[model samples]
Target chain A: MSTSADTVSMGGGNNSPSIRAKVQAFGGFLTNMVLPNIGAFIAWGLLTALFIPSGWMPNEEFAKIVGPAINFLLPLLLAITGGRMVGGQRGAVMGAIGAIGLIVGADIPMFLGAMVIGPLGGLIIKKFDGLLENRIPAGFEMIVNNFSLGILGFLLMLVSFEFIGPVIEAANNGITVAIEALVATGLLPLLSLINEPAKVLFLNNVIDQGIYYPLGMQAAAEQGKSIYFTVASNPGPGLGLLLAFTFFGGKTSKRTAPGAMIIHFLGGIHELYFPYVLMKPLTIVGMIGGGMTGIAVFELFDAGLVAGPSPGSIFAYLGLTPKGSFIGIIAGVLAAAGVTFLITSLILKMDKNTEETEEENLNESIEKSKAMKQEGKEVSAASEQHTTQIEKISFACDAGAGSSAMGATAFRKKLHKKGIEGIEVKHYRIEDVPEDANIVVVHKDLLDRAKIAHSDKEIITIENFLDDPNLHGLLERLENVSK
Target chain B: MLGEHLKGNVRFLESVNSWEEAIRESAAPLLENGSITSKYVDDMIQNVNTNGPYIVVVPEFAMPHAKNENSVEKTGISFLQLQEPVMFPDDKEVKVLFALAAEDSTGHLDLISDLSGVLMEDEARDELKQAKSEKEIIDLINSVE
Candidate 1:
């Protein structure tokens, strides 16, 4: 569960006149700020683009200088800039320090490192910024305050990079190796079997962070030479569907899927099929199967492209792809679609039976519970009495503040629509919630605290309050309680 | 050290017609003041023309700068803002500019980072944008807590 206040409070006091002024001044500073290193990047890019092509500089020497600088320095600058954008001077210094880890880490691209580390660095600095601000004394405030604070922030940023950089590097290495091994074992058939059903029916594409893109990009980046290959290899279950439809799909899927695929392809967005996957989980399985097969075929042919594969649609593939891998790409698409379609058709027939059995089991549990209540058991009384006391309720989610605040907003909207008032509604992070709260709602993943607090109050599990109708009903019941 | 680098040379501009004009216009003062050389201004203009609007480095802010060695008459800072918001293709919005003139890369690194921090805050950024006069802008800059 998330609440509006939690979300709203994360940015903290943007409405304050002074804070607004700070933001404006900071924006001006960033706009007018100059870094000499950027010229290094421009000069490097120009030399590489012009001289490298004309054979003025040998490829080996060019790669040594240009590759490391563009990959490392440019990202370092981005991290510093991003941090400054987020946290001001402290953030900029912190972001730059954090970005330095990417150069040392050497595995992850600088742009990606900057994108991740800069924000993380800003967040860490933001956590301590208030504490530092509070400790500044009155007399020497102007000199001692920002100066010491800047030094402290810079040191903290360096320490954070030292600690976090290794963990990130190890994790990247682990994932890369795992993906490589999976591809090398020629396990596409088994993967296709699992993936097709997951893609078509379970909304596998919705969890790109968990699947597809990470694996694809990791494999491509680790195995391939060019940046273009890394970009082109973005594995998307949605792209799996498009490849299936365009190259080998039946008439019905071909027409509808192509239009949606085109939008995602050009835009570099791949989450467009979430609604479709939710409605038909079987289709998702097909997509997963297709993705697995695609990777396998791609490996077999040793095809490569430039750039990371974010916009994983075909148009981006063709438009940005380096010359001479068309056959490999075609083969990869066919292999993916063939494997996906086969696996999906077989699994779709079996799912209907499983779904019926699951429904029956749910009904059986409800009947059993009702029968137990009719027997006047004291255990039933505990549940009944507990439900009665939950008039006012609140919950928490990630960032404890922001998501919880958003949840509170949704809960209130639902409460209003049902004409339920007088039941106080609030949101908090799990860390900040009061022990006296009568009813607490929390994300299913973060239910440990709620369970512990359950000794005093009833706890409701919510999968995300944003659009959960079932959660709205549960909230309505809790709010309608007279006590 | 950051304050020393920033003193006297920083200016608050009223407005400019476009991002290109803003850079050229903003750099003019720093060039005349002997804080930077004409070559620095030329390089910044060229960088912007070649690279898409990477200068709008912060939200509602743009920094028009080039390689420090190109300009470096003396290490300095200049501030400018548009009467109307200018578009940086990469940025969401633009109103303020910080044109930096560093003699070398290492000389102003710390000051550049420190100055970036001050301007990154929404409160500071808005204050600078709303300043009616150079005195107010300088006061706001001096008032950073």
Candidate 2:
């Protein structure tokens, strides 16, 4: 089942999940917001590539779809999705209303602005809904709900409409000017310094969506292609790094790196190659060198893609490539991979005298990345000092037959009543609480067994499954976090 | 589904000497009907001995069960209402026991859902607790269903 754990930080009151976990969770959220609407981007990219005046098939009628789709439809979808993540269905509606303002206000497409405004609108409605909790009279719930959203959405539309104009004007000047400065300086390849490490730490989304996409879109709007999109997403470095490990790594790493290479290069999932780099941290030098070469090549050729290549796969890169950019794009990817492989192979050969073994690092990095991925699923874990937003709560008992089932069911009912979203309540045996669970709840009597089963976890003990003081505290804490 | 499973599996008892005896007595109906073997009853008691009184899920309520381990022939639920509360580990005073014999985890969920519904609301819990006879218990559980 596609559970909602990956994008939210689901932790209990006591757990202190690592900072890496929080970043992955936020990255997961951003990726979800953009990944779903990528089809729209591709459709627009296809239309633009095929039917624009300079294109091979240049159909005026088909090309008409490109402008409106990127300008209105794509941005609206992003805003709607952003809203739904924060506020649910109603939030989605609010996000669209808010985003329409930015689209009309800005001279350019509002991808970056829509991303910000969508969540803001969702938060606005979610907070408003939270306030309206228990205050609505029973019979007037329908009318109050309708009028409230209608009235709030009307004002939100106006606020965003007016607010977006000034925000876009400032952003236009800021990003466009900064980018032009960077282009003139010829130091774009230095971005690999940030991109390589951030990718391994699960910040690929942040640097891609947060920095490059906006820059690329702006430059592309003017020149039909920009080197910005290819800077961070080039998969060549990962390919080189993994290929090096496949040839020169320890026994386990050598065996594993080949499979990872396939998934990373052709599959375009850069995450597949991270374990290799993490196992041999020094190999990052090779990745950085590869990335720099790729960027330099792209800049030299003045090559770019029509759309951002999500997953960073070679296939996606080729698909999104503008007609004349093929030569340069392919050259950049090959050059980057070749450079990274050469450097990585040299490092692996030299590191034979080091205390660290490639297998050990590989194993630890695999485990660490898994931990980070799980945390990413935990939607919005606020902090340990404050009550964290919980996503998965496991109700554990000796058999997981009767009592735990009853506890999970009752807790689900409470969550439903309180309008808490994204938390998964399920019954599990004391020994079988899933690795993804943010908290484990057990009857106080079984504390010893639970401790023995999961010594690493935070345990919530209760005397009564239905009505316990501790459970009451957790409910209050959850309510506060959601608010 | 729960009411059907619990039809001939309900019992009312005056008392039991120990929590182990309470589970044996509660599961007696399921055992006699071939839903589970005597080993299932012993394993349910052994579960508490090893894990303590966690089976006493709420005040005055306990659900005794263990891994089927090939001891269960069919899934079934049996309820027993003790006239006087029996002392369990951790000094839990339990007056009701729901001895579960599940063939597998997912198969017995309908019955579990019915039981949760019965216990979730204060009014329904009080109603089930006040029930006197086997028919009354079955009727109360069914009402929630």
Q: Which ten residues in a row have the lowest lDDT in candidate 1 chain A?
A: A1-10
TM-score of chain B of each: 0.83, 0.95
**What is the Å distance of residue A404 in model 1 from its true position?**
30
CAPRI quality band, candidate 2 = acceptable
Q: Report iRMS values in order.
A: 16.9, 1.4
Off by over 4 Å in 2: A1-18, A354-356, A379-483, B1-145
Q: Chain B in candidate 2 has what TM-score?
A: 0.95
Question: For all the candidates, what are their Cα RMSDs to the real structure?
Answer: 25.7, 12.7
Q: Could you tell me the lDDT of residue A258 within candidate 2?
A: 87
Off by over 4 Å in 1: A1-65, A74-89, A105-117, A134-146, A157-163, A188-258, A265-268, A338-483, B1-145
The CAPRI quality class of candidate 1 comes to: incorrect
lDDT per residue, candidate 1, A69-134, as tens digits?
555666677677667655556677778877785656555654445656765676566555534543
